[model samples]
Target chain A: TQLLEQSPQFLSIQEGENLTVYCNSSSVFSSLQWYRQEPGEGPVLLVTVVTGGEVKKLKRLTFQFGDARKDSSLHITAAQPGDTGLYLCAGDSYGNKLVFGAGTILRVKS
Target chain B: SQTIHQWPATLVQPVGSPLSLECTVEGTSNPNLYWYRQAAGRGLQLLFYSVGIGQISSEVPQNLSASRPQDRQFILSSKKLLLSDSGFYLCAWSPPRKLQETQYFGPGTRLLVL
Candidate 1:
């Protein structure tokens, strides 16, 4: 099974602060996705990156796929209280199945 | 305009009890359905997926099993439940014909096994 490792399992920051989360893997993937999950709810897709070195922006959130397609990162600028949630990164591997990282819980304090 | 529904938003059951959770998707056809389990502080684990009626693929061997009885209906069940089964159960769907398509999730069901 493909494994995706996420860094900084937990993060707390004051509002307006910036934060970044990283997802790394040893195996290459066809595509990668980022999701945000609020309490008691299933994760919602934030973005999907298909090409190596691809970058996509969703408002204040910026996502980057590594040049090797083996890693990805998410950066939030001027974080707000609404930005708090559990962030997850998933990789699409053989059979079009997604392998997910453990997840990073982020809290943006007001 | 697609929506996925999972019933019994929260369930509390004693150990060894039979388990049945249902998921149905509306507003689409031939969509890919998936079942996932999320333990505390863990990521979503793919348990099963189906591309069509009566076609199911098991991703991990465990106390849980999944079935697709209709075009857009998926079910997760177990003859007997275990305490370790307590977690958040999620059902997701993606558009057909692509493995890398984006997936939309349901509201989710919280299961607690005592």
Candidate 2:
């Protein structure tokens, strides 16, 4: 059973386009993190949002934590081919384990 | 300034064979460690976590077990490998400050059980 759900399991777009991915859950979380993974590498931390209604940005990526702490969103601006990879959002519920969403595989054609 | 490392970037093991994977953390002490498995085309599943030496919390009952013998060391071992164990194993750590901490992951070990 997946604790978190991500929308648009697969996305393909041309360069310069914009897209948004979402992660939703019924349970509340203390903090949420966004990660990007390449073809053969582990997921790299992008940004973290701790407070409800928090928003953080890293370069072309923007992250938002829902006020209720049960959802999050990641938006990419002017997407590039280099951004093609898997995007994952994980939530920490008060322990060592991080519950991850199903992930969104994005493909940007140059 | 913390780093996490996992051994055997890629492994090919036969079924029914014993398996062992090791993870180590540097530049931090008494950190919270975690073990996660990602099947092909699937999301990560938390297997176990540890808060301190000799402390383990398992989230799933599987053929695998984890141990933390040292403050900076965590190990995942299996008495007998199963084909279902073929997946990407990731090791992560976060400071023990809060439950909502952001965990950093290692490069991960890709295990292929034949």
Candidate 3:
């Protein structure tokens, strides 16, 4: 089974603090996706990385895919209260199937 | 523009009761549909996925079952509810054109078994 392990299951920081969440796996994936979920809602797609060593940025968020396609990271710069949520990383294994990481719960207090 | 809709934002049912959750997509055709469950403090668990009508793939064998009666509609049902089944259920869809397509998620349904 393909499994993605996420680090720092819970993180709480004050506003303007920076943090990074990591997702690692032994199995290589064809693609990886990052999502942000708030309470009482489904996760929203933050970014998708398909190629090795690829980087994508969305405003204050930065996403990176590992060189072997077996890991990924999400970095938030100057986090605000609005950035508080559960960050998840998912890896595509087969056709339309995704293996998800444990997830990182972030809380940014303003 | 594409959108996905999941019904009954929240539900509280007694144990052993039947359960049914519906999901539908609009503005897209021949999309891949997926059902995922998320427990508190954990990530999503792939429950079921449908590539086409009447084609369902189970990721984990459990009390849950899924069906797709049409190209744009998917349903999750169970004959008996389990207390462990209570969680946030999310429905998602992706256009089947790319190998690594991004999925769009619905508002989701929160089920609580009492």
Candidate 4:
């Protein structure tokens, strides 16, 4: 079975602070996606990285796919109170199913 | 534009009660549907996926079962509920053969078993 391990299960930071969350795995994936989920809602797709060493940016967030396609990272620059939520990373394996990491709960205090 | 919907936005049930949750996708056909569960502060746990009508795949071995009766409708059910079944259930859809493999999610259903 493939497993995606995420680091820093919980994070609490002041507004304007930057943080980085990492997702690592031993198995390779065809694609990796980042999602942000608010309270009482399903996850919302942030970005998808398909190529090794690919980097995508959305507003104040940046996502990176590792060179081996076995890992990914999400970085938030100057996080605000609006960034408080659960951040999840999912990888599409050979069976066309997404294997997800445990996720990181980020709390940005204003 | 495409949208996914899951009914009974919130549910509270007894431990031995039967379970039924509905999911439907609109504005798309031949799309892939998925069911996932998320415990408090945890990531998504893929329960089932379907590529077409009457086609279902289970990823975990548990009391939970899933079915796709129609092209755009998926259901998750269980004969009896367990305390562990309390969590947020999410339904998602992805366009078939999309290179990015991005999934759009519904508002989700929150299940609480007592």
Put the candidates in lDDT order, highest first.
1, 4, 3, 2
User: Candidate 2: TM-score?
Assistant: 0.95
How many steric clashes does model 2 contain?
Answer: 0
> Which 10-residue window of candidate 1 chain B scores lowest in summed lDDT?
B94-103
Winner on lDDT (1 vs 4): 1
lDDT of candidate 4 over A1-110, digit per residue (tens): 88999999999999999999999999999999999999999899999999999999999999999999999999999999999999999998755578889999999999
Clashing pairs in 4: none
- Scored by TM-score, the top model is 1
* CAPRI quality level assigned to candidate 3 from its DockQ score: medium
> What are the TM-scores, per candidate, against the unseen true structure?
0.97, 0.95, 0.95, 0.95
Error of 1 at B38 (Å): 0.1
What's the number of clashes in each of the models?
Answer: 0, 0, 0, 0
DockQ of 3: 0.60
- Candidate 3 residue pairs in backbone clash: none
Instruction: State the local distance difference test value for candidate 3.
Output: 0.91
Select the stronger candidate by lDDT from 2 and 4: 4
lDDT of 2 by residue, B1-114 (tens): 888999989999999999999999999989989898987755788899888999998998999999999999999999999999999999998887544478888999999999
The native-contact fraction of candidate 3 is: 0.59
Could you tell which candidate, 3 or 4, scores higher by DockQ? 3
lDDT of each: 0.93, 0.90, 0.91, 0.92
Candidate 2 docks at the CAPRI level of: medium
Give lDDT for model 1: 0.93
Best by lDDT: 1
Backbone clash total, candidate 1: 0
